[model samples]
Target chain A: AQSVTQLDSQVPVFEEAPVELRCNYSSSVSVYLFWYVQYPNQGLQLLLKYLSGSTLVKGINGFEAEFNKSQTSFHLRKPSVHISDTAEYFCAVTLSISSGSARQLTFGSGTQLTVLP
Target chain B: DVKVTQSSRYLVKRTGEKVFLECVQDMDHENMFWYRQDPGLGLRLIYFSYDVKMKEKGDIPEGYSVSREKKERFSLILESASTNQTSMYLCASSRGTSGAKRNEQFFGPGTRLTVL
Candidate 1:
């Protein structure tokens, strides 16, 4: 089984400031990592994914995440944030290719990013 | 762009009534999913179908049922609408099998259902 933990429930940052949202996971096998963002009254949109190679993966909206195997973490980072970035972010994980089931993604509780101007 | 469409944007239902939420995808994806979103709890999966007439229970499937009569359409059924069932329901579809590179699920706009 795979589970995800997003350590922070909420993060407040001033506009144009850097922000980091922490995420960790526990899985017996290799896993795929993903980040999703949800705007008010809207569905989730994929921010980025880490399938293979490149520990640092860049995503849309100038966001990026680093996949750290030793730390069992995939933390999302943005050099500068905007008011439009205020939304809910989720971290998710699924078992790697070796797992035949094409394991369903398990998501964290989510972190609400509030960009203060 | 891959589009996933839900039948209703908002619905109001009385207690004990049967509620149905429909979702359709134009991409002809092989897998479809249903989830409910609540405050603080995020999105919880109710059911998913990998193929026509095939379904699987997700994390929270106790109060709901699902149907996949065709490849592009999936429906979520509420046996008895209750106050607790009032929530934002989201539907998603993916293009390929579970482990494939196209595993990213494309989501619909969502439907807000209220049980009175």
Candidate 2:
């Protein structure tokens, strides 16, 4: 089974400031990592994912994430944030085929990102 | 673009009453999931169906049941609504691939259910 853990519960940053949301996962076998963003009163949208090859993955809305195998982390980063960036972010992981079942995903508690003007 | 649609945007139900949440996916995705989102809890899977009539229990499926009578539709049923069951429910659909690559899931706007 794969589990995801997001270190930060809330992150408040000023406009145009860079921010990083930390995520860690635990899985005995290989796993796929993903980041999702949810706006107020809305459903989740896929930001990016890490499957294979490149460790650095760029996503929509000027956001990016790096998959670090050794640390078992997939951290999301943004060089500049705007007021619209204020939202809740979640990190998720799913077991690879070599492990067991790949149907369901294990999600983190979530990190609330607030961009102050 | 794939579009996942939920039946209700907001619902108010009384305790002990039966509640049903409906979801439909336009794309012919093989997998559909129901999840609940609460404050600080993020999203917890309630149930999932890989195919019609094939259902699986997810992380939190205690007071919930699911039915998939058709390939494009999935339903989540709350046998007895409780205060704790009041939350935002989201529906998502995804296409299944054989490899380890994660498939993008299209989500509905979500239904906010309140148990009174």
Q: What TM-score would every model get versus the actual structure?
A: 0.96, 0.96
Q: Write the per-residue lDDT of candidate 1 for residues A6-113, one digit (tens) a residue.
A: 999999999999999999999988888999999988888999999999999999999999999999999999999999999999998878764324546778989999
Q: Candidates' DockQ values?
A: 0.53, 0.65
Question: Across residues A11-90, which tens digit of lDDT does each residue of candidate 2 receive?
Answer: 99999999999999999988888999999988899999898899999999999999999999999999999999999999
* Backbone clashes (count) for model 1: 0
Candidate 1 similarity to native, TM-score = 0.96
Off by over 4 Å in 1: A98-103
Candidate 1 positional error at B61, Å:
0.7
Backbone clashes in model 1, listed as residue pairs: none
**Where does candidate 2 stray beyond 4 Å?**
A98-100, B100-102
